[model samples]
Target: MSGSRKYVRHLSTLVTFSVATLVVAACAPTSAPSGAVAQNNHTDSVLTVGLPGSLSTLDVAHEAGILNYYVAQVSSEGLLGVDTEGKIVPALAEKWKTTDGRTWVFTLREGAKFQDGTQVTTDDVLFSLDIARDPERSPSTAVYWAEGTQVEKTGEREITITLPEPSVNFDWTVTASGGLWITSRAFYEAAQSYGSSSDLIMGTGPYRAVEFQADSHATFERVDTWWGKTNEKAPKKIEFDFFSDESTRLLAQQSGKLDISLQIPASQQPQYEALSNTQVTTVTDRSYVGLTFDTAVAPFDDIHVRRAIAYAVDRNSIVSSVLNGKGEVATSIESPEQLGSHIGVESARSLIAQNLADIQTASFDMEAARAELAQSVVPQGFSAELLYPTSIPELGTAALAIAENLKSLGIELTVTGKPVEQWITTLGTGEYGLSYMSYTPTTGDPAEITGWLLGESNPARYSQSDVRQLITEQAGEVDDAARATKILEATKIALNDVIYSPIWWGKNTTAFASRVLHPEINSYFFMSGWASQIGLTDSQN
Candidate 1:
């Protein structure tokens, strides 16, 4: 592991539902407004966005969802913010440095103030971090900060964090998406319930939340006193309206009621593209969707049984047909974009391809599946249940396909769907034999998702000392190339062990009205004030 200030900075930087019913209205073209009224509407400094899901809470620590993060980012901020290119940049903390990769020091920017007109002090930062790291307060995020880690104010405008061990990618843990959003301690302690509809969270971001209606909509207005550079073309007011139904969202887009719409279903991409005055953009995102097995279970505990199911499922067919050619078949759990963060993308791609070339990947073959099953302890058939969230219908479809394929090998697979909350609880309790896992990477670090899947706390209950050692080494390895190599090695081990079968990597499609200039849509864009990048087109302006 190389030790250098510039190298550390560079390395650190590198780190649904529904449908139907209203289809007829979605297909129908909306009536066009008069030219004069349209021009005025397009030029107005108000941006209305249609989100595919509802926001459950403004306090991401209480209940964190993609939508919740998206909304929280509008007004709140973290110590660091990820740029569109996935590099860690300054936010509340203007500058940061780590000499030994174990202890990090950050210098706060001058004149930073919260939305409530309170000066941001070192006490506020300490208080916020303490709350974020508390297990009871932030159950979903407390894992990022280990028990022995320590944080203290070293100066008036500087804070120091010492991790339990040397971690090259520890900086990512303080990012907005990484779950350490900062808030004023004064406002937080006074509020009866912070981040609620009545007492919305306060922060030092460019926007201030004015209204929040649970599972309905939220509104924000630009703050004139923000310390950071403000975009002249940024919208003065931004609104997020939740549309749980895809068709209804499509209808809203078609009717010109939304300036921007996100998470367009792959099946409805053509429909969204065909809409008038809309520009549809799609990109391969850093999200992993796959099948995980509870290795503690009898049949799944047998490696041969796991390999048999892996060989039987046709991943290519699922990506092409079920995903409508919107995504690619995943050969590994971590996304290529993440692994490529330290090195160039092309180099990382070649490295992964070359390293895993000799490993036996589970391809779709009935004979191979039968042979593997025959070698398992349960040579005969065994019945087990596979569970997925009801919100994601594609997972259910893919589960059915896998169940059908496994039938030929005397395996009786039962596919079941539960509500999102129930599905999460079921997974936490390890109540299912097999399950579907859909994870969105919070940081650019390659270890983010893999650390959870292959780490000691993995839900699969599968353990490999070699893989765990590699993961531990990579976390503290300062050299970019060395860290990437170790990650790939662990990936190979996990893939061969068949603890989790790779499915399809996801693609996100967002539609913007023609009058609105398209914003940079990337994996980390949502972690910052991304909407500020949206502006009126030349013609509209």
Candidate 2:
């Protein structure tokens, strides 16, 4: 790991589903707006966004979906905010530094106030961080910021954090998600209620929530007294209307009722591009769609069995048919493009190319796969079930392909498709033998995702002491050279272990009406919380 290249930590983890398990009603929309209005047609200053699902909650601690984060980003300010380039930027904290590797100090900005007009102070920061760190209080945040950490008010506008151990990701965790969003202690204690139907959440953000209707809709109005930059006509109001169906969301965009729409299926991208009034922004996310083998299970417990499946699956064919050639065949579980890892895509490719000469042009070697399977405990493969969620068609399709390939190897693979909720429950309880999963990078550091896979609670029940130690060391190793070395060692071990087989890295697409002009749109931090920067164009471009 050299300082010359950014060491990227992609939060894009093994799961792409909204972390929130909010159940959405199945009732279809009764009506939709008319066809797209002309680009020059100036309507009200409201920006109607077609959300893929209803928001679960306004409270960051309660929900992990990007939709809720969208609301939180507008309605609250964290100690830090993620810029479009995936860089951590100052939000409430104007500057932060560390005197010792285990301790950090943050200086708050002057004159910052919450949406309710309450002044933000060091006490509020302490309160918010404490809750975020407590497992019983905020499960979503506890994973990012470890519990038992100490916080002290060092000055009127400064606070200090003392970690039990040196953690390079401490600041990244604070800035990674809305969970670190600073909230008024007075308001939370008095209200004792947040993320309800009434949408009574307060923060020091650029917008304030005015209306929230569960999974139906939520609306926010710009904060006139916001401490951030804004324009009078630049989306004075932003409304998120949940449309669970992709077709309905597409219709909303085409009908001009939606100024922005997210997570549009890739198969429909061509149709959307043909529309004259829509502008689509896309990136091949660091997220990977793959299969996780439960190492605790009999067959997968054998490394030979795992390697057999990896060799049998035709990743190129899946990318071509399922992903429509919009993805890259994953060479490793971690996205090759992670810059924060110091060894970026170019470096990764060069290294992989050098180490594995045949990787550059490899094909499915069924014979090789069969040989590996023969080395397993069961030379004659046994029947097993492979699970996938119906929400992502690509996963199911790829699983089907893998099933077909496995059949030739004397393996009776049963592919099971479940709805998002049931699938999540099944995974949580370890009810399946094999699974096709997705991973999304949530932070600028690779350790977040890498460390998670190696964590004790990993659903796959896969662990190797040597690899685990390497990943654990890389987590707190601030020295770039040492961290990179540890990451490489762990990655090599993981590759050899073959605990999981990666298929492809999918592209994330966001479509907006032609009139919208967003200067920088990124896959990181996703499409949430852009109301303050979204501007309007006089003509379609």
Candidate 3:
């Protein structure tokens, strides 16, 4: 949510809060065909997962929504994968080793074949990686982390990757991004359309695409011969039914139609928890929502003006009131779970602590905000527009709070709401005065956030030569301690510049009927490895 991927909003029909109480009739789960037998010794033949956002594309190359990544992970696979514990595990590649910082060797698992029955080859790996790195075809979000990486097939089962320069956590970069999903070149070349639910995407994952209806639902049948199979119960078929309306999704959950539901509303969490046959799982994530300042704009150009807004907004209050205490105060873009964010050596810890201290010590003082505003060029204070997506209720609440806070400092703030697409377009233009945005650290590495701030289209048009140099140096450095020091140093500079007004770190809440079991959900954006482990209890009611 924090890096380049933040701009990729879930495209859906905007549902207003006024209509949230009107629940659409819940749809019952469709029955599996008679031939669809339970796979991997599971009792249930189908797993019904309800999604609040619609899947934009099945093509991994052009996937934008975060849920689409989960669909890709279950239907396709990468050379590597992140497990629920946040460790890098084998997917397509059974094991890998690196002799030097620049070169890495990977060995594919034997007998592993795509859903289409074609044996996965070294050529497929190279083809997928090459396409991912091609900037013209894919967004920079997918390939920027692997900019100068080159791949060569050494043998039938082995491939070697050579980096232009050493990258500290290169494996993580590939596992976290979407475009790295290994696809069957033969099938893709012959197919009329890529990423369509209708198109058969041949992947080496646990599930195979059986049926796809655009913006409606997608059904996937389990592969009995999948290499990653475990003794745990595996759903024979997984169906992702898209219900953009939150009320409809909640109704589906309450009516026993949905096996799993994600992003449960804070207000409705208690209602679900009180139910006898339901369980809620929540995990604190690296994603943070913040107000970004566009420095190209007049008032935002002044450091004092930026710092004043940072001090004026109470992050803790937002977390408690707007988020219903479902989040934590975010001190910086890089969360504590990410590497180089107080997770390493003493020096790195000290640097991260300093940034947290800066955030903590700042208070919401009206007098202080007025003092800072007086020092700015526009002492009389000017009218400003605050933009945010109308779809997210918390964002609107935060914006209204910020507007009130700015008013106390003699700044007239005008809050405006736009659809996700329109809001993202305005953010990219760098023409906005003030706006709220978010970043979820997809890569467990901190460099993703630092490197993204330096991107041309970043909402915060902050350009400091020292910070940029440090980011570049840390990006290719293989030594963890060295990279941590550089990354933390850059973080301090960015915090001092007040590029982003830190808000709150959110927790991903997933709800499941009491019957749903064994699904391995992780902290990453995409809930990888979910399909193979989920199962239904004998008592479906």
Provide the overall lDDT of each model, using Cα atoms, as 2-decimal numbers: 0.70, 0.63, 0.63
Residue 164 lDDT in candidate 3: 79
Output the lDDT of residue 237, model 2.
74
Candidate 3 C-alpha lDDT tens digits along 1-541: 2221542321111100000011112122222222212222222557788865555556545543345555666777778766655556777877887755568788887888888777887887888777667655444345353456778898879988898776556666555342366878888777777667557567778888888876688888877657776324556778888775777877777766777786666666787676554577777655667777888888888978887788888888888988789887876655555544325434544656764576522467767787888999887888988776543556777888988988877889988876443454565457776767555555556565556655433557778888877876886776766777677678677777777776776766777666655634556525346565565544232
Q: What digit string (tens of lDDT, one per residue) describes model 2 on residues 102-145? A: 78888888998888777887888888888777767664445565
- Comparing 1 with 3 on lDDT, the higher-scoring candidate is 1
Candidate whose TM-score is highest: 1
Per-residue lDDT for 83 in model 2?
64
**Worst lDDT 10-window in candidate 2:** 1-10
User: How high a TM-score does candidate 2 get?
Assistant: 0.84
Per-model TM values vs. the true structure: 0.87, 0.84, 0.83
Clashes of each: 1, 27, 7
Worst 10 residues of 1 by lDDT: 1-10
Model 2 spans with C-alpha error above 4 angstroms: 1-43, 66-71, 176-179, 190-193, 198-200, 339-344, 352-363, 371-391, 410-428, 479-482, 525-529, 537-541
What would the per-residue lDDT of candidate 1 be over residues 30-127, giving only the tens digit for each residue?
A: 23222322222433777788875555567767654455566666778888876666667788888898988799998887888998788899899999
Alpha-carbon deviation at 501 in model 1, angstroms = 0.9
Candidate 1 colliding pairs: 15-445
